[model samples]
Structures are given as structure tokens and as C-alpha cells.
Target: MADKMLQGKVAVVGAGAKNLGGLISRTLGADGASIVVHYHSASTKTPADETVRAVEASGGKAFAMQGDLTKVEHVVKLFDETIKRYGRLDIAVNTVGKVLKKPFIETTEKDYDEMFAINAKAAYFFIQEAGKRMNEGGKIITILTSLLAAFTGLYSTYAGSKASVEHFTRAAAKEFGPRGISVTSVAPGPMDTPFFYPAESPEAVAYHKSQSMNGKLTDISDIVPIVKFLATDGWWITGQTIFANGGYTTR
Candidate 1:
């Protein structure tokens, strides 16, 4: 088998300033990969800087960049800057996503467009750009949601938009396979992040927790190792969505 260790590899982590993204950056850095940490909002700059510091502390080179990845230009610049700074790209992991839990009837056209833009469009371009710029044998992963497997409602837009990424993963994997690039998506269950609370009510949160093992939500810690695995040891897995939702939902 090809060596799967991350040592000497270069990685670009989208939305990598905080939460799950931050942890993934730090973990990969600890494993000896240079990092390009991408954050979106101005508010995320501090976290991005902190993540870069953490990577550097781990003896891996790293720097922070900001971009609204829903824009293709920004996505292009993100990979371009990674190449400029590091000279090569071996892994790209996109943790960019948006969540909305509204009834189908209540979802506006604007909401649908925005959700698809952030969840689907951004992911597509990220993969496309990574495939264009990465070295042979690179790995690409996108963060998705476990809701894609649930027989539920109230998240029509959020889940539907994320659902599109599964197909993108498959197509990209096929097209990029000949180049030795592996493409995959990860669907983590309802995680305990600020990102999960805004759209959830108390009771709904409780219900989500009840469905998972230990009657608790997924943690950022729980998911990062899975991502790290994909980027390294799990390189054999491609063209599929691995649900790491603590048994909360599955196909």
C-alpha cells in the first residue's frame, strides 16, 4: 500500500478557523502536515490566527486566509494562495456549511438559493479547484450532515442542499480517480457546536440527542479523527459519504 502518513504533506482546510475545522487543522499539523487555514467571516480572523499558531506550535508551517467560498473567485484564490505559500497541495478538507430548519412551505426562494450556494455550490468549486491544483494521490473531503439519511422534515432546504454534495463527491471521485486523487464526503450527526443551536429548539435538541448513542450530540472531537483518517489512513475510501453521526442516522 502507498504510505498514508501525512508527514511532509500540505493541506488546505476551508472554514478551518474554528470548531471542527480548527481541530482538524491542529490535528493534521500535529501529524506533520503544513496547513493553509481558510476562514470566512471577519469575525473568524482571530480564531484563524490562533489555529495557525497552534499548527506552528506543532512544528508544522501554517498561515491563515479569509474568503467567502460561495464565490468562485474566492475559492480559486484560496487554492492559489495555498500553492503560492506551500508550493504543493496534498489534501483539501472543506468544513463549510449552513444550517436552516424551516418547513418547506415557509422556505423562501432566497433561502433555498442561499442554502444551495453555501452548502452545495461552495463544495463543488472547492473540489474542482482542489482537483486542479493538488498533487497526485491527494485527498479531498467535505463536511456534510447526518440529516441526509433521516426520514424527517423541517430541514428541507438545509438537508436538500447538503444532499447535492453526495453526487458531487461521486462524480469528482470518478473524474479525479485517474489522477490518484480521492474524493469523499463526511456526514456528521447533529454536533454540539454554536452552528447547531440557532436553528434548533430545546425539545428538538433533546430529540436529536435521544436518537444518538449516549443520548448526546456529536462533538467536534468525535468527528475530527474520522476526517484525519480519511485524509491519511482511510485514503482507500472514496466516492462515498461516511456517516460519523454516532449512530444517529444511517443509510
Candidate 2:
């Protein structure tokens, strides 16, 4: 087994069913931190079960917790449950987001509202609630999108949502600095996950691949190290979003 990087620590990962969240859960769990697998209804699947099993097998601890991050009460309840079970929250990594794939002309007010509710609003409230309950030296990592910088057309709403989270991450970091809580965001490029392939067009996918220095989608394996570093070893790092793209647009 690997060294216990975060032995006896507790981490709550929002949207930790599969893909990025699952990977984050497993990575932290493997490092010796107990995990809270928070998932939304749409993400309900065996991924949660599988993640819990994987964590336990790796000499870590984990439990599955479901809640709608869009609601403030749910966010409070989630932290409450985590503290009740694990005693205190040492880390929190939020990987939940609302992605709207509609064209600009097709976008509506409802779409804007829903997107913010999930991406910005929920994240905002989650940080608010979690920040209040977190102990000193706690870590908070939020997952945003590199699209905020690229602004690839046809994703106005999606970009806006991610941009908001990026801003929130920075602002929260500054606010939580005095408390010894570090807030950071992970802005990843196109990753080889269900969230990327199903929603993107062939042309778009090819275009993104061509933009990369390696000409490929971001691998979940490659992302694990960045997450692990920020979640555990990055005590001095805060208020910055680390881009985990495979040389996709240096900007």
C-alpha cells in the first residue's frame, strides 16, 4: 500500500458517483482519507457502489450520500451527515456542474436559470455552508472548466456557468484564508469521460483534439495526480485554478 498521505482525514466529494468525481474519490481514498460520495439523482448508478468498494479495498474508508446540491438545505444536510459520521471535514472537492448544450438562439431563461442553479448557485451555497463548518487547515477544491478561458463558441451558457464558479473559487479562497482553509479550482480541458463524448459533436471533438499538443483528450489517470496534490500536499497553494489539460491551449 501507498503511504498514508491523509490518514484519518475526511473528505466530501460532491457528484462523486463516477467520472471525475469517482476518480477524485478513489484518489483521495487511496491516500488514506475517508470519503463521502455525494451524488445527484441523474448520476445515480453503480459507480457509487463501485467507488465505495474500491476505496475500502485500497485501505481507505467511504460512504455514499445523495442530495440535490441546488438546494441550500441539502447542502447543509450533506455537511451535517459528513460531520456526524466522520467527526469533522478535512477536505471538500466539488465536481458538480450544469452543462447546457443548446445553441445561443435556442437558449432560454429557464436554461440560464437551471444552469446557474446547478453550476454557480449550488456551488455558491455549498461553499457557504461548508466554509462555516470546516475546521482550520481544511481544503476546498472545486472543478471548473478550461472553456472559461477558451470560450469555444456554441457554449455560451456552459462557459458562463463555469466562469462563475471560477470567480467564486477565487473569492472564497480569499475569504477563507484567515480560517486556514484553502480554496482552489481545477479547470480541466476536454476529458475522456461520458460527460465529454456524449455531448460533443465529431467535428468539435476533432477540433479539440487537434488543439492539444498531444492530439488527444485529457485522461482521467493524468488528472488524478493534480487532484491528489491539491487535496493533500498543497497546503500552501490556494485561490488558484490549476489547468489539467494535456497542453491544450497554454492560455
Candidate 3:
């Protein structure tokens, strides 16, 4: 217990039932933080339950909750419930996002709205709720994409929607600074996750693999350590998007 980096802390992990989010929830819980694992749909509830069980099985505390984070009220409830259960929030990591890879001309209004709603809008309000509910010195992290730094096509909506969160992170960092809350985003390259594979074609995948080191896609494992650092020891690093893409994209 004395060695746990986040002993006695509490965290609200958005979309924390699977993939990178699930790993984060488990990692934070292992570090001794009580966790609120949030999932978006009924289909994900089982994974949410599994995550909660895994967390507790690791000798940490955690529970599962459901919400459509695109709704501000749901986002609020996420934090509210975290406090209700754990009585404090020391960290929040929002891994909520939707990706699209369609020709700009073929993209529709519905496509753009859905992308922005899940990627940008949800990220914005997640930060808002975290800011309001977290105790002093808390941290907030959003998952962005390294495509934000790429001169690529077919990802206009996905990249565009995530672009908004960088600004939100910067502003929130400044506004939350006085309260000792650090806000930041982590941009990983095309990750080796189900969330990524469906959006990419074989040719696109090969090309993405070529640009990064090791001829491989980013792993959720690679990104999780950075998130952990930001939530704990990396407190001074705020208001910036750290690209953890293995040289996939820079600047």
C-alpha cells in the first residue's frame, strides 16, 4: 500500500470498459485508486463489469456505470456518481471518441455530427465535469490521435473533431491551474485496437505502419504508461498534447 503511487485517490475513467480505456481503469485501480468505470452502451456493460471485477480482484476498489457521455448531463452524472461512491476524484481520463475515414466529398452531415459529438463535444464536457468535481491537484486526460499532426486524407471528420479537444485541454489547463488541476491530451498513432482496425484499409494500414518505428502500430499498452504518468508524477506537464506515436507524426 505504501508503494502504490495513487493510494487512497479516486478516479473517473470515461469509456473505461474496453481497449485502452479498460486498461487505464485497471492500471489506476492497481495503483490504489478507487475507480469509476464508465461505459456507453449495454453491449459494453459486461466488459465494464469485468473491468470492475478485475480492479477489485487486484485488491483495489472499483464499480461500473453507464452513460452516453455526449450528453453533458450524463458526463455530470459520471463525476457525481464517482463522488457519491468514493467521495473524491483525483484524476479523470476520457478515452471517448469516434473515428471516420471517408472521402471528404462522401462524408455527410450525420457523419460529421456523430464524430464531433463523441470526439469533441464529449471531451469538452468531460473536462468540465472533472474540473468541477475533482479535488485540488487532480488531473484530466483526453485521448487524441496523431493524425492531428498528419497531412492525411479520408480522416477529415475524425481528425477535425479531435482537433477541438487540444484547444479545450489548453484552456482548461489554464483555468484549472490555480486549483492545481492539470489538463492534457495524449495523441497516439493508429493503434492496434479494434477501435482502429475497422476504420483502416489494408493499404492504409501498411502505409501507417511504414511511417512509424518498428513497422508496427501503436499499442494501447504504449499509451497507458503515459496516461498513468500524467495522472500522477507528470503533474507539471499540462495544456499540451503529447504524441506517443513512435515518430508517426510530430509537431
Report the number of the highest-lDDT candidate: 1
lDDT of each: 0.94, 0.85, 0.92
Candidate 3 per-residue C-alpha lDDT over 23-66 given as tens digits, one digit per residue, 9 for 90 to 100: 99999999899999999989999999999999999999999999
Where does candidate 1 have its weakest 10-residue lDDT segment?
A: 1-10
* TM-score to native of every candidate shown: 0.98, 0.94, 0.97
What tens digits encode model 1's per-residue C-alpha lDDT throughout 126-235? 99999999888899999999999999989998999999999999999999998888899999999999999999989999999999889999999999999999998898
What local lDDT does model 3 show for residue 7?
Answer: 92
Candidate numbers, best lDDT first, in rank order: 1, 3, 2
Report the alpha-carbon TM-score of model 1 versus the true structure.
Answer: 0.98
Per-residue lDDT value at 184 in model 3: 96
Question: Ten residues in a row with the worst lDDT in model 2?
Answer: 1-10
Candidate 2, which segments miss by more than 4 Å at Cα?
1-4
- Model 1 has an lDDT value of 0.94
lDDT of 3 at 145: 96
| Candidate 1 ranges beyond 4 A from true positions | none
Better of 1 and 3 by lDDT: 1
Q: Which 10 successive residues of model 3 have the least lDDT summed?
A: 1-10
